[model samples]
Target: MMGEAARERRQFWWFMLFALLVIGAGIGLRAPWPADEPRFVLVARQMWESGQWLFPHRGSELYSDKPPLYFWLLGASYALVRQWNIAFLLPSLLAALGTLTLTYDFARRSWNHRVGLWAAAAVLFSFQFVYQAKRAQIDPTVVFFITVGVYGIGRHVLLGPNWRWYWLGCFAAGLGVISKGVGFIALLALLPYALMRWRGWNGLSEPAPRGAGKWWLGGASFLLAIALWFVPMLVTALVSGDPEHRAYLNDLLYRQTATRYVSAWHHHAPWWYFIKVILTQWLPFVVFLPWLLGPWRQAWRQRDARVWWPLAWLLLVLLFFSASPGKRDMYILPALPALAWAAASFMPALVQRRGLRWALWVFSMLLGVGLLAVGLAALFGNPGYEARLVAERGLEVGSGALWLWRVLALMGALIVIAGIVCRLRHVLLFTALGVAVTWLGYGFGIAPLLDGESSSRDLMHEAREQAGADTVIGLVNWREQQLLQAVGPVTEFGFKQPEDEQWRRGIAWLQAEPTQRVLLSQDVAMPDCVDRGQIHPLGAANRRSWLLVDAQAVAGCR
Candidate 1:
């Protein structure tokens, strides 16, 4: 049998494989959901169908909230898979895996192999990391590029001076900029190290001065790569003479990056919003954060670049995002690699402190007991939470909900058992495994059930049924957010709600044929008799619906 350290070392590959399987469990199970997924997926779908690689469209209109790299990747994947949900999400998933690989390599380069593996594990089970990794969001993809840039820059500055690595880092930073608005913020992470290097400050003295003119080469590469997208937009705008096109490019360059940071239009939160998210959403790892401070302090005192580089990386990234008014819990995801590396630095040198060990033991036991109680509640509690919620919302659910309750209960039981068993030793490993299992259950069991109720597929099909296949289906006073749920292409007929255009135009388009319908998600007060249209009942699916001169009512009205 292998010794304990050797056995632990050998377990690395298996753990990585397990992490992937857990992350991958629910990628294909649900439809593209609203609030984010469907709109972006539809953009990719439209981009592919039109064969327009440069600009993207949301249905009929040009979409300009973000840059094009994420859509480009998503569109390419979707073109190959021919499936909406799977291809839409694969880019983020692959980006997550890339991020993990980069994180592991970086930690390995900085410390020993075991600490690298642990750093990878730290990222794998992070609450915010896994949450964003499983979805079709652009943050994960952006984070990967950020990680690559950081790794390259860290190597160039901290470990040894390498011009090639510095150039590659700049190239990645350029790609990052095209991927999202503030990707260039990642490059700012180098400022602290650069400042330290210039001053011959602590931890940066003995690496020897950099080779001559190296900085110029790196700066040029970043500028050139970033110009690839901007220059095309400029040329197109000049040739086509579309003012909107020019505005779009200008917004991407400045407004989205600077204006939104200072006065965001959406997701507005205070300066302390990130502080709250860091404490709450960055779970498991956040618990180990205080311990990290000691390592940082030690690094500062000893002038150790290996340790202090990661510390600077984390603080600079965190402060950069915090300065923005447009705050989200996942906005800080690009900083996690730094955080993980910093935390894992302490792991290799951890002493067998009895007091710390005993406290963890007690905490684990208590958590186990609480988890067991929750499992019992899930297994046998009356008025199941899912059922109660469904009933309250005036929604229907199938027997599948029951199965979810049972599976969740079983997962809870397993978590509790693992927690109790590892109470005295390997507490983090046990906790990480439990979190992975819980997330797997969420993906496979809990998510699909929720989606079934939320998706308006049935209502969309019903609209098609009430009207003919060719009838113009217009969403009236309903946000175009879920237009991706339509059985076929539909027009938007609402205004001033951050959704679509006016209703009169849509009514005219529908009345052009005399057998179309306008659907509303909320009830509308209709006159006693509608001469031009009649309300079509959709029961619970829609609040009010009208056929613009219904086929049967058309002749009657005339």
Candidate 2:
């Protein structure tokens, strides 16, 4: 008994060490928030500065695609950092931490401490979770709420009926609705639990306790919480006189959802798209899924209500997202915690099997090593030839840091070795494997990708430097507009104008101020100048490249 307790204590700390390592690895490989993250952050910042909570703005335009809850949270975070680049990522970081905590709690209660630790480590290290959590997007936030709702429901239904737990579940669902439109998915995820409970009640010879009233109260509270956000938005839409506000309502409520469900917007991949992503995204754990099915069956046959709830949640979320018209890699995040729980339940059995454990460890280690090798090559490998090509062609190399390759290589090798050692010892090898894979993939592999895409930042800085403080910057194309907007203010010249007039005006402007440095996409031809100078290519600190033209060269050309 004493030895077992000592082992448990050591295992507990090991899990903590793995979780912290995953978090630290992510922090080490940092980048500015990508498209949705930065866009949402900007809206949140605008709301905070403008003192308008209901209406979010991006510069002068009203941005209303998403609810204000995430922005509100991010805005509060921004208040502390005062730097948009780093501040916007706070919500994601918090959500990631919350996910880790909830995963740990669910796994610990369902299985043993070791399984809980593995589940937490799996979530922290999962490539999809790591990549999404580092950004300023709402996926992680939605996943957090979903996890909370699942945990609450599991406790309420599995551990006997507790009104407080049910109420907490409702609260989580409400917050989920505010975070994203997918809050109802949580309820769907619980259907398996409801079914199991009903079956258990049927088998009993004695009359079951009547608790419909409790369920009603919980459901009502959830609906009321959701109404707090939705009702106001609906009323504002009905009363607002501005066409733009009405347009926002139409687009956000009807168009976006309807289009997403009925007509594909962006990602129109085949139905099997999610299947591939799930298989690869979960990686080593996906291998253990076969082991879960047997236990899942046993739990269902025994009417083990505790186990079925998480299984139901996982299936329901997967089915719901799979059916949606709009899908992305990140859409599957909400399902991961439940999957982790299910996977963790089988961990002890898996650990006991020497052959199976050895195979898993070897495979995971090799995969980690491969990923690490790629990261290291990207980080340290000289793209000198690529850089020269970009410079010669007057194009920015969009790919980022050479050192990222090295980081990936080193991390991958370490993980592979750890997985093998853990398997050989028949110890808590899964936890070690999970830690190594997550730290390297997230810290070294994905972080470098973010850093490599630094062309936009560099371009913005160069434009600001050359254009002068008072220069009126204008973009020739939408792509240029996106790149320019990311860095500094540059008016979009061609969005509203007729093609002929827009092109003519753009050319004329370039001709009129050849001495004023202007940024143009590589596709655009340089104006005729008497003494044309070379175009200067801007290198991104980490990822992509861009080109900057001298104002004097353009002036001299004509």
Best by TM-score: 1
Superposed Cα deviation of residue 374, candidate 2 (Å): 4.1
lDDT of 1 at 355: 49
Give Cα-based local distance difference scores for all models: 0.69, 0.64
**Which has the greatest lDDT?**
1
After superposing candidate 1 on the true structure, give the runs of residues whose Cα lies further than 4 Å from its correct spot: 1-12, 198-212, 348-388, 391-400, 478-481, 493-501, 520-558
- Candidate 2 contains a number of clashing pairs equal to 48
Give candidate 1's error at residue 143 in angstroms.
0.6
Model 1 scores worst on lDDT over the 10 consecutive residues at 540-549
Instruction: List RMSD in Å for every model shown.
Output: 4.2, 5.2
Clashing pairs in 1: none
Score residue 70 of candidate 2 by CA lDDT. Answer: 93
What tens-digit string does per-residue lDDT give for candidate 1 at 328-433? 8888888888878877868645524554555444544554455556546645665566456555332445465455556666776777778767765676667666
